[model samples]
Target chain A: MSTASSTVLRGRVWKFGDWVSGDDGIVRFSELRNFADDHDPAELARHCFAGLVPNFAERVTPGDIVVAGRGFGIPSHPPAPMALRAAGIAAAVVESTDTAFIRRSLNAGLPVVTCPGITDAANEGDVLEVDLAAGRVTVNGTVFAVKPFAPAMLEVVDSGGLVPYLARYLAGNARA
Target chain B: MRQTVAQKIIARAAGTETVEVGDYVTVTPDYTVMQDIYFYKNIKILEKLGVHEIAYPDKVIAVLDHTPQAAHGSIYVDRNRESREFARRTGFDNFFDVGRAGLRHLIMVEQGFARPGLLVFSDEPNISSIGAVGALNVPISTEVIVSMVRDSNWVRVPASVRFELVGSLPPGVWVRDLVQAICHDYGGGDGLIQRCVEFGGPALSTLSLDSRQGLLAGMYHAGADTALADVDDVALAYVQERADGRPYEVFTADADAEYDEVRTWDLSALEPFVTAPPKHADVVPVSDVSGRRITQATIGSCASNRLDDLRAAAEVLRDHPVAPGVTMYITPGSPAVYSQAAREGLIELFTERGATVLSPGCTTCWGYLGALGDGDVTISTNQEHYPGRAGSRKADIYLSSPYVVAASAVAGEITDPRPLLAREGKPHVHS
Candidate 1:
């Protein structure tokens, strides 16, 4: 478990509409069946958003960020966010999302920021900068404030998700 | 400070006197449940974290409810076998394997694990059904591994929204309709996100335990963090009969407790409603799509597969055969429900009327049984009708009450259940 923190991410934006289903729009449920036992990041990345956006896997470059309207990741399964991270999505900024989805994304090592007016602030193909520590996003010279992760949650993401965080905790405790 | 039922429950679990909303606190849940579908994944995550010992074996339960019969394939069979072995190795005597298991939500309630004021950690949010008895369900999704390994989880105490339901539901209109009505009204915006919904008001006392469970189970579709209902005699009696000597505390909200919002709903004014295909927020009255043809019908899910729901379906299908070319499937929520339905001849009535009786598990609801073919249209009591949820992406699923699903099965179309119930003299009163 690598404890690498990319607090600041710069990427092109992939804007989506409201209520983009995490299962169908982010990653098709059928595609998840292929990697049920072994969730290979590269293999899962190949099918990200294959249903909604044709050749999305081929067109998308690493370090791209996903921006969407309200209720993003509704009816999301756990694997949906993992698929996004595996597909090299640096962060997700949305108008709003369920708390469960937010937690799931952070656990998958993807920072999900909830900004009230993100959909209207950013557009497709525009470059955006996300700062996790500062809790802000910059697009087109405009900055949008986002709800920052709690200090504990930031530590979890900094450690590359909860598993590694726990691993480090156990190791530190053992030394003591 | 006065605290709502949810706040009080969380405070109890945290071993604190009071916990305000938004306060992040570490809590030791009363119980933690694992189901078949995610059991392997959870174990894999635990292994990755290098944890071996069971933190609290007695407080842990493992059940093979999703694919109990291995309907999907040998993968489920392999997982179930591995789950059995894990249970034995961990000394988790609370494990419920196939034939002994049903939906984990209903199992938690029927076996008296979900007593009033207790906190439970589960994988799926719909396990909020246990809240019918005032128990709080905290769904951590795949993060349930955190609780399993550490025997504790961190939670941000959520604000509460109270639904004051008044008056009794009219004939042919069920709790499922009432839930859909709530979703239709408050599901669109972020009003319910990260908030706990509390069901109260005069109508709550009139509702049976099954009806209350159905209502709370569907609260997740409305984007609630979790839901709980006011516990009354109806809930307490049901728990008393099945509690198996478990000690429980009954907590009620203080009159001066704070809430994010409180809305009143008149049950008698509600009409039969259906969530149109694809979007749960696109709920409409049954009359909007009454005559649409349906190729399949199902009356089973964690939300609406209790005895009253079965009886409602049986009442509609009695003395009538399922329409030709229409396949109907009925699944009981738990083994206890199945046995009671069988004793009451509800199962026989359904089978005789050409409706298939599946095992007591999440069968059709989870897309394990009665999977739809391409272009098939189904009226179901399942929780979700999202695209590709049931089977082929080309197929469509409309969500409705058991009464509507059963009547639609009889007519091979989405038919309002009131007309059919009127023709049968009167609607049967649900217990």
Candidate 2:
């Protein structure tokens, strides 16, 4: 795996959010994440989501730092990024995580981080290490403060984000 | 580097000049999307153009869904007369008559009007709603229809608001809510004036077809046109179906499609969002401003008010009553939706909640129905929240999802729905 420089988020790293999985056990592509004048949301939807989500449940492994931007959890349909987190496809979801994704990740017990300016530093495959407590990112071990992520957010990340933490006690349980 | 499908399509359509950012190219529209008013006018325009029989009338569609009824009998008659006359004169055999369809964008997909790789355009803001098809793709117009029809290609320009979304979002929160939040984050009504807005990121796939449509609709600012990805097969069906010969080629950039700016959004961490009035694109978290009182609130328009939208609102209004001073109106996108809602008990629920259900048509949000009196504060699901959208230029309008609107109707203010729904520790996934 190639490491990037922390001075400026200069590496290729794939991002995974809580809003990515689908009902048919497939990976769904996000339109907002991609911007193109000729892009067809429907075609992308069918290509990525019609039958499956990224299949990250099986495709992703540990040590992967998923880079995220803001307002991530905006999908109305369920079974997205939640299932991926539950399956342990992502090691740490970092960057501007939205409220819904945060809530769902915490419930699923996924590890997530929120570090601003991280996207600019990372590319599609660059491995990144982000230290939330120090508000620093170490790409290939070089460090920079860049921007600070909320400390309160770390607690949620530590709790596995949302699903795994909550699912253990509530599987098949009736509404209280 | 591999060329994207859009790039390939553009290359195919563009014979000489390669399509690029900021390049003024006429994108031939494979299919034309029309709403109620323009369909009538276009028939007259066609007569003036002196084309007795349409060259590709099969590729064109006429959807009547604007004003179904007027307060005054004469006005109603006049509007209907124009609508019927246009349908008859244009030889438009493919007409989605009122009461049989929902919004034009939604119906276009349900009826398979949109197909993948098909370049499509319309003369309105709501054409962006077709982005939900997941396979059928095309260019949508933000300007007048006549210009696009004369020359199929819309000018390819860079976006002013480049939102890079990276996280997961809540289920109830949708594209409409996020767009409203963006509009709110900007200046509400004037932020996107003449500016292109591009929404991108890994989180976009998480949105449903309907939600994507809502986002496309929300991108309409006075300054720029609207567009979205129709990169794959499901999208192809929608585009190909509308193509004049074969699917209009997709126009995309080579890995490096140029963009003026980029903003990222993490869906996971986003709260159920909202955008308060006088601005259609302004956006805010539902948690930040729910329960704020209002005078009038409405749901339904060319851009919003689908069956799912209505169902969500119904879910919230199930047992609640409208706030004492608030008067809520729920207008189905078309007569079919109206009938379906009635059959499904959504209409009854809306009525029980003290909501007034209007005849299926474009009302409050389209600057029709004299929807508001002076000083009326309205919350709607329409795409843009400009002044005079609701009859009164001074009226304040808040844009939100059906859930937020319904919740606010009961609380009598801009309040979030999380607390009322009492959703327990569901996983909050952010990118």
Candidate 3:
């Protein structure tokens, strides 16, 4: 676990209704299997929100954010978060999400801030700034507290993902 | 420090003597059972993680239920192909593909992949569907499969909620009815979120293994993270009967275990409860919606559909035929249950009465197969009734016990099942 300076993420927000499932909402489950063997992350990225949002792949821009209701990115699918990162999204701030959704986002090296009432403060297309380490979010010119990443989880994300985290762990073990 | 059964199980898996509520422990699960729906991404993720050898090949249990018997050009086939190859390369010992089993949750317990007090991860929130045998199962994310292969994952010991069920289940009253009552008492789907619900009380011992499974499987309806049933002689004998001579251990909660909340109810107070659609706790008596037009009737799934369930359905359909226009699908929960149902002539009775026997799988209930047409009203013996859960958002699904499903199928609408089950000389005790 490392305690580094708090990182601030700035982006335009996109909102989804409650429980927009990880499989159907973030990306179609079929798209996951169709391009699975291709080993192409961009292929997954292009089809992100394929069924839920029309022209998602064409319209989505870098550093755009998603503000979802409870149970965001649920159903235990890994490719959902990876597709988010590959699409160049900055972060996702949710009212609540499943542990797996958060962990998958961490594995994808994506930041997810769980905050109550933050969704109400900002409308869709609102510009927001999320400070990771500080547990603060600025939307509608208002600041509110949000859940911060655990020191260890933050370190894992800093290393660029679980694969690099494991590599770092193995290297450290070898040195020790 | 009064520890609960949920805590004890986590303690053992975390390699600690004891643990308190909210303590996050790094745990290596005894068995990780993955269905085909979520395993495709896991395999690809493992490849990217540079996993040469699976960390616990012997501990992995992969079942092909969600996509069992893949059709031509189906996405399910793609998932099945990649997942099978990944299991082969990773050297996982137990991969139950199509024709072997339907639901991994039930198949895992039947094949001894899960037993008392062994940490189990089934990936979906419905993992507790196997808690009947005293196994603590977590419905986790796909990343968990990756962690189980590469290293381990952290588990925070959840505070246990005690459910004390007492009294006897009268005719037509099943665990499905009792579960709805529990959900209503605990706050519907919003209640057990993130909490560990522990079932107890005298009547628990009398509930059949299938009934216990139904009770456990109902945890997802209330949004429970996981669940545990106190191991009794009934659960023990059932485990031995299905364990294939494998060693199984039990963990008991301390006599004075602390509970965040305790709710008690008598089974005699329950009747044939039913859920209309969408939310599980959105329930009322079957008589409330009697004669509501139904186009489809299904009597099978991972949760409620079992041998006893099939028998209950057959009992109603034995003497009478299905409604003139309404069609019914009878799916056994597993190959073993399917065989038993066939041996008991339940399959014969169903087809003779205009019911179609489906292959054993989550098929229609999950909307992967047996999808209903638009605006079709269905009465099913399955758990989910959520919008678009049964493939079509326009179709309405009613969740009920097999007894109710059977009777309702005959009438082509929601009907009280009391008359169908009150017949004399009933030798069978439907779970």
Candidate that scores best on lDDT:
1
lDDT of 3 by residue, A1-176 (tens): 11244266788888886666666678755445432233367787786787678877677778888887766765435678888877777788987665556766876778877787766787988988888767788898889886565555666666666666666654563210
| Fnat of each candidate | 0.33, 0.00, 0.18
Kindly report which residue stretches of model 1 are placed more than 4 angstroms away from their true locations once superposed: A1-4, A34-37, A137-145, A173-176, B48-50, B71-73
lDDT of 2 by residue, B140-186 (tens): 32122333234433334322345666766665565565665565554
Question: Which candidate would rank higher by lDDT, 1 or 2?
Answer: 1
Question: Where does candidate 3 clash, by residue pair?
Answer: B124-B139
Q: In candidate 1, list every pair of residues with a backbone clash.
A: none
Interface RMSD for all numbered candidates: 2.0, 21.3, 4.2
TM-score of each: 0.95, 0.60, 0.84
lDDT for each of the candidates?
0.84, 0.52, 0.75
Off by more than 4 A, model 2: A1-176, B1-10, B15-17, B45-53, B74-76, B134-164, B184-202, B222-224, B230-253, B280-291, B334-344, B423-431
* Cα lDDT of model 3 by residue, B117-185, tens digit: 888876666768678788988655554555445445666677888888899888777788887877655
Report the Cα lDDT for residue B412, model 1.
94
Name the lDDT of candidate 2: 0.52
Winner by lDDT between candidate 3 and candidate 1: 1
Residue B389 lDDT (model 2): 45
Docking verdict class for candidate 2 = incorrect
